[model samples]
Target: MMKKTISLLLMLCVIRSFSQDTTQQIMPGRQNAIHQQDKPYVILISADGFRSDFAKKYQAKNLIALGEQGVVADYMQPSFPSLTFPNHYTIVTGLYPAHHGLVDNSFYDRKRQQTYGMQDKKMVADPYWYGGTPLWVLAEQQQMIAASFYWVASEAPIQQLPPTYHYFYNEKISIDQRIETVKEWLALPRDKRPHFISFYFPEVDHAAHSFGPDSKETAEAVQFVDESIGKLQKVAAASGLPVNFVFVADHGMAKVDQQNTIPYPTIDTALFTINSGSAVLQLYAKDKNSILPFYENLKKNAVDYDVYLKSTMPASLHYSTDDDRYNRIGDIILLARLPKVFNRGGRPTGPGKHGFDPHYPDMRASFQAWGPAFKKGLQIQGFENIHVYPLIAEILGLQYDATKIDGKLETLKKIINTK
Candidate 1:
């Protein structure tokens, strides 16, 4: 009995020592590992309304060359309505239309009962006006900086710091001038360089809206944006600060058949307004109750459009929630499945029109990335706008809340050499 007790005590002591050592080994700092990784400077470029087919159809040598040097997605499916403001916001926030609070290009706030559009800079620029944290805000928080040539939320005063620098909306400005301004910023000293940068070209989207998607004008505009990307890349190279450019579009477009086109019913006092996308229509009603009748009427009557409440919106849209900061989406959402016109501003005299349909091939946007951090000759499956947000955050080496976002940075793991 004495020998057994001694053995037991020895074993107990050994076990206690092992446990203590293990406990010390895994103390707080052990689990609190800081993953410090080398990050790359990121530049995001948007060719408004440019579609995936443009890559195969148009001879965009610069874009194609960029793809050859990096990765190209089969398509970058946009969020709901595949419209401009919402989709662009999605790209930066990594959330669906509903979550990001930019449900559409134009929407009516039920609380304030006010209409909103990109042109409404005062409201749009308010950080409180948005829901998710854009990469710019994330970069600022991480002590890294960001810049923008002409992006939707770039000019907005968000958090304590917005983009380190940005150009307010200037419709009359030329795309080249925008590129030049970006170049000037890129020339800043290495320590002063922004970790992330974004540029938007609305010319192609404008041209597509003015002249149908198939028009020679639209094709020419694609080439123009491609050349613009080329020039920007050249400037970055000249600056000796290698930059990776991620080229994307807010949404794609499809030509509306005149015979098939149906105009939306005119409202009396305009209970709601709309923000046009390549194929989505985000409607906002002044009275939430009015939305039900309006939505039911569209579904029962307008068989051409796919309508849903913001809550009922499809998960695939990457915009499947309502944001407190941006809850202005109409009670009933109307998405045109067929190529048609909503004609909010009275039959826009344009050969082209978006804000209609997405599932269709013509409505799928494009994506391309090239630079030191990108893999050459790589191709990826088409993804959503939200994916770009995480990828941008990853490239800039900034931490972000992926939980709030519908996107993930793992999407770029194959393209970037983390090892």
Candidate 2:
């Protein structure tokens, strides 16, 4: 009898450990109150290249309503270079661009001498390229379901696992289709419902890159997205389910003209090359010594662009070099403050773009939150891109280290009910 009793105790201990691993941090928590919802959900929306000015200029009625009814951060300044992949990764991992990887829109790997662009999903989706626990992986590890639509890095595996559901960025699909897909998942049977959902709208970013951010075309795209959000609001209300809706932009946009471009040598020998559009260029260095001479040539001979060593990028940008992101970033980083045409093989490109420093107001992101959990009429200001990870962890009632992030949780506490 004594032997049998001891065996039973040992089995109980094993079962308890397994159960804890599956159940821990499943639902987010406030300091005092364990929110009494059946299972809380988050609908994260990324409005790519969305600037607060668009919100101010063309009336985003649905977003404004969401802001007034819920919570709005005055402005969320994006991380360095104000690029897409980096900020999107930061939003989930609570790490800066340096820590999380996805350093820039297009970067060159020094050791490999290859360039990686976000559009090339085949290469950019490697799990080894990223670090830290992305939110989707964190949810999955705790046994919760998560899904994403057209968000950056969604196609990549995190922690060797994919989100429960994901759409691998089909540009052919209309924005309406994207909204419907999100609604369909939310409409799933309670047992199959996704505990977290992320949605991305790319039309505005595309339009801004083609036209300019301040142009009417970009404004129209903003309105179109706002209308879609309005539809999402209707669906969520009719369902009467407990959910948190977060709307954030990867970065804002900037306008460039004839002045923004710079021409590389007319010959195509290809020591270094510019990829046109935003004056950013890629350099193929024969040796480390070539980097400085190349930068000097652009400054003295070209006279239109400014360049920097990827490793020694300006301090204010808060970016990292020699890591995953920097590997893709060109050996020499270029920004054109003055208007000029830039071309490596003398081929011209688009009229506008972004992905420069985040300090510029035009690069600041937009933020809005609405749900049962948030405080109505609460306003937060000066929130940075990295802070979003910790804030979302708070909403999910999960354990997170806010200190590991450049973003802060205290600023969001006013909107969340601690007790």
Candidate 1 on 319-388: residue-level lDDT in tens? 4444434666655566766556555445444666665445667779998888887888998998767788
lDDT of each: 0.71, 0.70
Off-target runs (Cα >4 Å) in candidate 1 are 1-39, 266-298, 307-312, 318-326, 344-349
lDDT of candidate 1 vs native?
Answer: 0.71
Q: On residues 78-125, what C-alpha lDDT tens digit does candidate 2 reach at each position?
A: 887677887888898877776665666766555565666775555656
Using all chains and alpha carbons, the TM-scores for the candidates as numbered come to: 0.82, 0.82
RMSD (Cα, Å) for all candidates, in order, is 17.9, 11.5
